[model samples]
Every structure is written in structure tokens, then in C-alpha cells.
Target: MADVLSILIGLMFTCTGCLLLFGSSISADVDDQLTQDFKRFITVMPLREMFPWRITSMNYRTMAGVLQLSSALLLLLTSGVLSTIANMVLMVVMGVAMYSHWAVGDEINKLVPALICFSLLMIRLFLHLRHMPKDKKD
Candidate 1:
């Protein structure tokens, strides 16, 4: 069951990653939309604000694409500790995204996707922990 779910999620992320990676370059409409969406967060996100320079929309797209792609690969190609770790990282990323949305006073509906990803990744982590072998304390 978990494997099936993981693969499904992996496929979703893979598609999203590919779209984000290439869509920005392939279509002016996609690039413009991505730029507008990303502009809202890069300046307001807490960690991002600390940087000396502003992050361009293109950079954000590439970074987000890479992160999604790596997470998808981890979920698809590996299980056990690697998947758990990947999910944990994803959870943090999504958490930050949610926070950024909140900080910017965006519509709550805009936050749903990040919240869902964060919740799912947490569940994935918990499931991994539940199945981990107990350490024998001799």
C-alpha cells in the first residue's frame, strides 16, 4: 500500500518538477505566470529576506524544480531511510512555503497545496518510523 502511494506521489512530483523545469523556458505564458507567483514569496519569506540580493523568478523556478525532482527520485527509486529523509526535507520545504504564504497574507486557499504536501510527508515519515526495527538494548 505504501509503495503504491509512494509511486503515485513520485509520479505527480516528477511531472510537476519537469513542468516547472521546462515550462518556464518553453512557454512565455508559463514563464510569466511563474514569475508572478514566485515574486510574491522570494522577498517576503523569512530566510529569503536575509539574503543580500533578491532571488529572481527564474532562479526560484530552477531551485524549486530541482528540489521537487530530487524528492521525486528519492521517493521513486529508494525506500527505507532515504525516502524518509527525502520526505523530511520536503516537509520542511513545504512548511516554509506555507509560512511564506501566511506571512504574505495570501488567500488561505493558496496554502492548501503546501499544507497537504507537508501533511503527507509527515505521514510518510511516521509510517517509516512505525516500521523501523526496534533497537535491542542489551
Candidate 2:
């Protein structure tokens, strides 16, 4: 069960990374829809006033999105020493992405995706941390 659980988690991170990566190449309308969808989620509503924003105003978020997606792909395919290093790099990229979203006026109302991404990064960090050597007492 433990082995299966570990595999599931790893697969999920990889799959999620891939999923977000794929979102990058879509059209501007599609990207706008995705951002609005994210906003709707953070507001916790089946229905709400339509979001009053354009994804175009924040081009950096899209760049961040690609970075995150690529990082996720790297984390999924990579293994051994390279895998660990890649996963750490992925986390850092995603962290920058999360920051980019917040830096813009995307609003806390659009924060669900950011939080979800952060959670994934944290999991990757935990997995990598467990594989690291403990510090020695001086």
C-alpha cells in the first residue's frame, strides 16, 4: 500500500505538471477563460458576477505558466540524481510563478490555482527533503 501510495503521488505530480504545461499553448480567449475560472473557484461559488479582468494585461503569468508546466514535465520524466535536482528546480520555478500571479492585481479571488500549485511544490519539496542527508551535529 505504501509503495502504491508513493507511486500515485508521484504520478499525480507529474500528470498535474503535464496538464498545466498543456494549458500554455491555447488561444488568448481560452487563457482568459481559464483565469476567470480560477477566480471563480477561489471565490467558492457555483455562480458569481463575471470577473472583470483580461489575462492579456498580465503576460508574465503566461510565461510563468509555461515555466511551471515545463518544470512539471521535467519532474515527471527525470529520475535518480537528475530527477531530484529537476524536481527542486521545478519547485523554484513554480514558486516564482505563484509570486508573479500575486504581484499582479489578479486578486485573492483568483488564488485557488496558485494555492494548488503551491501545495504540489510543497509535496515535491517534502519528497526531495526525505532523500537528503541529515545535518551532522558539530
Candidate 3:
């Protein structure tokens, strides 16, 4: 069950990362949508106000995509501690996504996907920790 869940999460993140990183090359429509989304993200993202320097949305998108892709790869290719760490990283990313949507007053529909992914990551992490071996001190 844990293995299946990990694979599902890995595939989901991989597709999401690819969409963020390469959707512009896939189709004009996709590119337009990504552009619009990036604009909205820049306008509403709280960090923009907190930071002094100008940060382009493209750079932010690229960073997000890289983080998701790297974490997903780790989850897919490794096991035990590495997989657990990947799951935790993904959970943090999803949490930030959900928070961003809420902070911007996005509709519930826009927030649901992140909520679902966060839930799944929590469940997978729980399963991993539950099955981990405990040290027996003599």
C-alpha cells in the first residue's frame, strides 16, 4: 500500500513539475495560462512584500518546479530515510501552495488539489514511520 501510494505521489508531482517547467513549450494555451497564473502569484504572493529585491515570476516558477521534481525523484527512487525526507519536503511544498491560495482568496476549487496532495503525503509519511523498525537496546 505504501509503495503504491509513493508511486502515485511521485507521478503526480512529476507531472505537476513538468507542467510548471515546460508547459510553455507544450501549447500556446498552456503557456498563456501559466503566464496568467504567474502574474497572479506575483501580485498576491506575500513573500514579494517581505523581500526587498525584485524577483521574477519565471524564476519562482522554476525554483518550485525543481523542488517538486527533485523531491518526487527522491521519493520514487529511494526508500526508508530518503523517501521519508522526500515526503516531508513535498508536504511542506504542498502546505505553502495551499496557504498561497488561501492568502490570495482563491476559490475552494483551486485549493482542493493542494489539500488532497497534502493529505496523501501525510498518510504516506505516517505509513512509512509506522512500519519503520525500532531500535532495541539490550
Return the clash pairs for model 1, or none.
Answer: none
Q: Which number leads on lDDT?
A: 3
Across 1-138, the per-residue lDDT of candidate 2 in tens digits comes to 322333444565555444444555645676676666455334432122464543332333344455555554555565556655655665665555455556555677565665665676567567666776788999
Give TM-scores for every candidate, taking all chains together and pairing residue i with residue i.
0.85, 0.49, 0.90
C-alpha lDDT (0 to 100) for residue 55 of candidate 1: 78
Mind giving the per-residue lDDT tens digits that candidate 3 earns over 1-138? Answer: 899999999999998888888887878898787777776776666567677888788877787788899999998999998999889999988987888788778899999999999999999999888988999999
Q: Pick by TM-score: which candidate is best?
A: 3
Off by over 4 Å in 2: 1-28, 32-66, 131-138
Q: At residue 9, give the lDDT of candidate 1.
A: 71
Better of 1 and 2 by lDDT: 1
Worst 10 residues of 2 by lDDT: 40-49
Please report the TM-score between candidate 3 and the true structure: 0.90
For model 1, state the Cα shift of residue 90 in Å.
Answer: 0.9
Which candidate do you rate higher for TM-score, 1 or 3?
3
User: Where does model 1 exceed 4 Å of error?
Assistant: 25-28, 49-54
Q: Choose 2 or 3, whichever is better by lDDT.
A: 3
* Arranged by TM-score, best first: 3, 1, 2
